[model samples]
Target: MRKNEDNKNIAVIYWSNSENTEIMAEKISNGIDETGQKADLYNVSQFPIERIEDYDKVALGCPSMDGEALEKNTFEPFFEEIESKLKGKKVALFGSYGWGNGEWMRDWEDRIGHTGARLFDEGLMIKEFPDDAGRHACVEFGKAFASF
Candidate 1:
């Protein structure tokens, strides 16, 4: 069955330093498009945190920064501001990392969950740049999130 018009709006927001995370965001958007839906992609700096409330679904992508943490400047503040509003929202997370295990993603998931956002599924973490397999996973991730 096709999604209703109201269910089609999705926001894909991310912060990328090496551009790896942005690539992943685009792949996820491609997946969303494959599902016959479109998502507005935004760099965290450009997207208004309050506008997160406008979309029915949100997929946030950000690479791990110093000590496996969210990018300190843009993505972090954006996430912190919109977190409380995530209550009852449908959301997903994905990103790339240069080192360390996916501890950043784990903490992020737990933090978002505590705010009451309904997670679309497990978070997706790709090391360094996303290769073909990782991109494919991102597409599938987007498709799954769209399904939700």
Candidate 2:
């Protein structure tokens, strides 16, 4: 994977109520940082989404909520607001799920497909809370995303 991203702009924006998704976000950001690249990380509340066009690549994280769906309250609205704005950007998704065979992630991926963003690989889903290996997986995902 490419370890250098001297001119790329990347963002990792996430919303986490339970803190599980937050941990994953941290690890993913760590992987990006380890590669000598910096990712602008933000909680969805703190994200300056008006500057969406400033980023060439973005990583989004949220947990499954309300029967295998994206978190409806904050994350969903933000995603909807930005969906049409994401055309031509490289977008990656990740989330934590507690049940329902990860159908939520698949549906979310399909939605991204319609947005004109180049969805990177598959969306990463962690069952419930991530353990040590899951954290490693998140880090690896970050590395791969950086290279992508």
Candidate 3:
């Protein structure tokens, strides 16, 4: 675990079609705040990929589309642009889904891992709208990631 005085900067960027992922992103930021770490939250549309290298930790959120992976329009390009910048960073993933198994999260984890970023924990996922348990889990994920 990193020392509390490390002062690492963390960022959470998310794209949400139905607002669920956005709420999760806020919860993640809250968890990071609880640990007394600095966190920045941004919508994927406004996320500055060029600045990713300035952060020590990053958490990305995207809803599943067509039972496949991240929403294509914003997330795909954003991810691609930042992939090469992620080596050796601490990262986490989260998303909301309406249907299908959680294969999207697994695939995303694999892809991010390939970039050499250490995943903080298993990716956080929710079926449709997340319930209380799921939100709490996301918060825990944030706390754990901050400490990593």
What's the TM-score of each model vs. the native? 0.93, 0.95, 0.93
After superposition, candidate 2 runs with Cα above 4 Å error: 1-4
- Model 3's alpha-carbon lDDT is 0.85
**Model 2 TM-score on a 0 to 1 scale:** 0.95
Model 2: colliding residue pairs: none
What lDDT tens digits, residue by residue, belong to model 2 across residues 91-146? 99999988888888899999999999999999999998999999999999998898
Candidate 3 positional error at 34, Å: 0.6
lDDT ranking of the models: 2, 1, 3
Better of 2 and 3 by lDDT: 2
Q: What TM-score would you give candidate 3 relative to the actual structure?
A: 0.93
lDDT, candidate 3, 9-93, per-residue tens: 7889999999789889988888887888867889988876777977888999998987568898888889999998999999999
Question: Which prediction has the highest lDDT against the true structure?
Answer: 2
Better of 1 and 3 by lDDT: 1
* lDDT of the candidates, in the order given: 0.88, 0.89, 0.85
Candidate 2 or 1, higher TM-score: 2
Candidate 2, run of 10 with poorest lDDT: 1-10
TM-score of 1: 0.93
Residue pairs with backbone overlap in model 1:
none
Error of 3 at 81 (Å): 0.5
